[model samples]
Each structure stands twice: as structure tokens, then as C-alpha cells.
Target: MPRRVFVHIGAPKTGSTYVQNVLFDNAERLEKAGILIPATFAAHDQAMTDLREVPWRDPEAYWTWDLLAEKAAAFRGDVILTSEGFGAASAEQAKRAVESLQPAEVHVVVAARDLWRTFPSMWQQSIRARGTWRFEDFLAAVEKGEFEGFWEHYTANRMFLRWGDLVPPAQRHLVTVPPPGVSHDLLWQRFAGVFGIPDGLCEMTEPTANPSLGAPEIELLRRVNAALGDRYPHRMPYQRVVQQHLVKAVLQKRANNVRFGVGLDRADWVMALAEEQINQLRAYDCHIVGDLDELRPAVMTDSHSPGELADRQLLDAAVETIVGMIGHADELRQMIPPGHSGVLARVRRGIRRRLG
Candidate 1:
């Protein structure tokens, strides 16, 4: 039989990191089980790039369909590819991606979360990636549809709908992220089900804690990125390493930190819009794998109170993220051998030296 290819096209912020990390960390084990996750440093980047129409200069723009095709062709078993940013691609880009995979039975799996939560997380992510806008202002821009022009720019539900536009209804599998109270394993179960993997075979691994910016942290990020914006735009990976890992880590570890999420009023507004979109998606006859009620937004409660932390705590968290990312840094440095050890690697090494 021709290899059945499963493509998890992320709508972003739905445990994509955990999923990708698991696949990358266990590629050999998975391959032995007849599932193949192509080995590529850029698998996540390329999958997202193939779906979106972004500026070529963007770091994520490095993802290319031609490369993905080459990787797909080499797979010996059922192929699985994933990237959340792929939700942003234009119809044309989506068509090209499907065409590239030609002849293979392509199954597109999308994991979506409620907008009330997703919007804020997405905003923080942008800020971590070098965006300078205030949370309130960022929400306003998204409300005004200011970011609609770029492929993969933030649109609550618009991008979610695009998966349907790109692939046939029969081929699309829409997986809803269960609310916070549900076990995290719920997501993995649904994903495995779609791929025809037996339940309980793949262990539910701990996902990396991608700390969301509480209001205070968001404000701090805005200030830091504003100071750094002229020096580095969001398109640069080096900038992401600095802003996301180094700076944000310091702010989050501060004592009396607030948890990240929208204020009640704003969360309500975004959730209302999300509900409208969810209803629209249901109308389209999409194959939803989880309960829609579980997708509804609830009141935002502070997981932590605003407080100060000892400087040591702040430094520790930042150091951890930096250390974790060093492998990526090494890979990056190897690519640009002539480039200086760059700010990210330097900062990581600096943290380790300080900690030691």
C-alpha cells in the first residue's frame, strides 16, 4: 500500500511544541512502528511556510515545499508532518503543498483552541518574537483586522477556516483542544485516533511550559521589545532568542507575578467572536473530534498574584530556556560559520557561567 501521509497543520498554540518535540525526540521509535517523521531541522518551519504567504525575508519563510517534498519522498512508512503556522497560507500555497505531495493520501489534521485563550497566547508569542505592541493595542489591531494582509497574521477564526479551503472536507480532521480542566492527554488521544494509532501506545509526555505573559509580563515585554525593535525586527531568529528567552524569562520569574490572560471584559468580547466562528465552522460540516462546549470560554482567574520575585528566580528560568535552546543555537551557528557566536548563544553561555 502507498504510505498514508498525515499532516498536522497547526492552527497555533495547541500544544504543537509538545507534539513536534515528541516526534523529533522519538523519530526512530515511531519509524519502527510504521510512522515516519522526516528528519529536518526545518520540518516545523517548512510546514508552516508552505501554508502561508509571508515575506521571503521572514525567518519562517525559509520553509519550502520543495524541501518538504524531498523529505516526504524518502519516508519508508506512514508519513507525519506538522506545523501550526501553516494555518496562515493562501489557497494557492495550500494547493501547491497538496500538489507537491501528489498521489499520496494526504490527511490534514488541525488542532484548534478557543480564541479567548488563543488570542492572548498568540499576542504574547508575537511579542516574544520581537513584536512591540501593547496587549490592549494588539487586541485592537486584531479587532480592526489590521494584520489580515500577511499570511499567518493573527485572525481568530479566519485562518482556521482556510484549512477547509485548502483541502477536501473528507480529508480534513479538525481536533478541538479541550478546556483547561480536561486532561492534557485528551489532545494526544484524539490525535492518535485520527492517525489510527491504538490508544495508550504513545505515552503522553510533559509539554514544555511555554509561559504566557500575564499583564505585567506583557507590559514588560512591550517595553523590552520597544527598546530593541529598531535594532532587531521580528523576522530575525536572533531577536527571538534574545526577547523570548533572555528578557521575558527575567520578567516572568519576578516575585508576585500575575498569570497571562485577557482581562474579563476583553476575554468576553473575543470569546463571543470565537463562538460565532465555531458555529460557522460547524455549519461547514467539519469533522470535529471533540465537544464544542468544551471549547467555550470561561471566566479568567488569576493563577498567580502580581508580586516581586528574587532576582535569582528570574535568572534561573531565563537560564533554563537559554540552555534548552543552545542546541538550536549551535545548529544556527554552524549554518553561519562566519557569523559571531551571536547574541543568543552568548547570552546562554553567559547565563550558564553566572549560574555555575
Candidate 2:
């Protein structure tokens, strides 16, 4: 039989990071199992180039798609292409993606979560990306259809309809996130089943994943971005300090043990929208794993209002950011050349001697 290609298209914020980390970490085992996830992390970049609708540029952007397809055609094992961004590709772009991986039996896998559960996290992600809108205003923008990416990327009903336009319903697989209170690893099990891997076949490579932020923590980041407006307009520094250090390193540590959810007003509309999406998904002749009922948004009782953050809460978040930035500076200090910093070298030697 010819090699099979499984395209794990994403509707992000649905454990895509966890799944990618597993696949990339256990690449050797996967190769032994006759499956190959491309070595480079530019699958989506290549797809965007192929789609040509988005003005994306990378040094290798022009040839990534053809190169991947060529590699798949030459390899004996199955090829797996995964990127949550691909889940938002238009019908034409998806067609190009499918064609590029021709000669192999192509299957698309989509991992999704309940709309209500997804939005709060999505809103937090936007904040991490330097968005200044509060959760309420974000919801208002979504309902008004103001943000192009809101419905296009986060809404399952729209994403599936676009990707499924070309791929047969049978070839489209929907993996619904199990409702909370169940095993957190269940989603991985559902994902691994696509490639016939047994449960626990792959282990989580990182100790912690891309954790979510509490409302106050996210609001703090937004305020910081607003304060730094135009001063750090470049995407690189913002992504580095705010996204990498502030959000991931600092805020995630402080934000842990805190949970936030969609508010009551947002809940009703989100739940109704989730139900409509679930109904539409059911109508498709796709292979669905996990309980469809899991798509129903559970009653979220502990919602936090960004507007209601106490002065102390904001101050606490700011203090944590300062401490985290200090720690990050220490890490950077360690990375400096020993010849460049005699003080750091002596400090390192003292620490090493103490450990010894």
C-alpha cells in the first residue's frame, strides 16, 4: 500500500501544543512506527505560501510545501502534517494542501473544544498577543462579527465547513475534548488512536505546557502592552518579553491554581452556538471520537471580570512580573560568555562549589 498522510489540522487552543510536543519529542519512536512528522516546524508557513492569499514571508516560505510533499512521496512511511493554523485555511487553500500531498491517502484530523470553554482561553491568547480589549469587549466584537479571525478560526461550524468543502466527510475526523473532571490525558489517547498508537505510547516531553492566564494576570499584560505602545512596536521584542517571558515564564507561574471561565451573559450565547456547531458536525459523515455531548458548555460559575480586578490584584500581578523578569535576567546572565563577565563566572563557580 502507498504511504498514508495524516494532516492534523488545528482549530487552536485545543491541546495542539501538547500533541505537537509529543510527536516531535518521540520522533524516533514514530519513525520506527512508520510515521514521519516533518522535521521543520514550518508546515503552516508553507501552507500559507501555497494558499497565496496571506502575505506571509519566510526565507524558506516559497518552497516549503513542495519540499514537504516531495519528501513524503520519497519516504516509505506515513507523513503527518500538523499545525492549528491550517484548520483555518480556505477551501481553495485546503485543496492545494491536499494536492501537494498527493499519491498518499490523505486524512484530516481536527481537535476541537466546546465553544464556551475555548473563548476565554482564546481571549487570553489575544491579550498575550498585545490586545487591549477586555473580555466583555472581546465578546461584543465577536457577536458583532468585527474580528475576522474570531469566527474564521475559533468557530468550529465555520472552520469545518471550509476544510470539509474538499475533503470527504469520511476522511474528516473530529476529536472533541472531553469535558472537565475527566482524565486530562484523554485527548492524547483520542489523538494517538488516529495512527493506531496504543494509549501511553507517547509521553509528555515538557514538564509544563502553555498554561492559561487568570483574568487579572491577562489584564496586567494588556495594560503593560498599552503602556509600551509604539515604543516596542516590533513583533520580535513584544513576543520575546511579553509573550515568552511575561506570559509564559512569569504569569503562568502566578496564574496557576486560578481558573477563569466565560461569564453568564457570554455563557448562554456560547452554549447555544456550541450546540449549533455540534448539530452541524453531527450532520457531517465524519468520524468523531469522544462524546458529542461533551461539546455542551458546562455551567461556569467562577467567572472573573477584567474590569473588576482589585487594585491589589493588579499590584500583585505587577510584582510577580518584576520578580519573573529578574529571574529571566539571571538566566540570561548565565548565557553570557564567561570572558565577558568575570562576576558571573565567579558566581557560577561559587554555585558549582556549593552544589559539590
- Using TM-score as the measure, which candidate wins? 2
* Predicted candidate 1 versus true structure: per-residue lDDT over 159-249, tens digit per residue: 5455556567777787888888777777777887887776655655787765665555555556556786556654656446665555544
RMSD values for the candidates in order, in angstroms, are: 7.7, 6.3
**Local distance difference test scores for all models:** 0.65, 0.74
Give the candidate number with the greatest lDDT: 2
Residue pairs that clash (backbone atoms under 3 angstroms), model 2: none
Q: State residue 292's C-alpha deviation in candidate 2, in Å.
A: 1.3
Candidate 2, residues 168-195: lDDT per residue as tens digits? 7777788988887776577778888886
Which ten residues in a row are the worst by lDDT in model 1? Answer: 302-311
Scanning candidate 2 in windows of ten residues, the lowest lDDT window is 54-63
Off by over 4 Å in 1: 50-53, 56-63, 145-157, 237-241, 301-356
| Residue 270 CA displacement from its true place in model 1, Å | 3.1
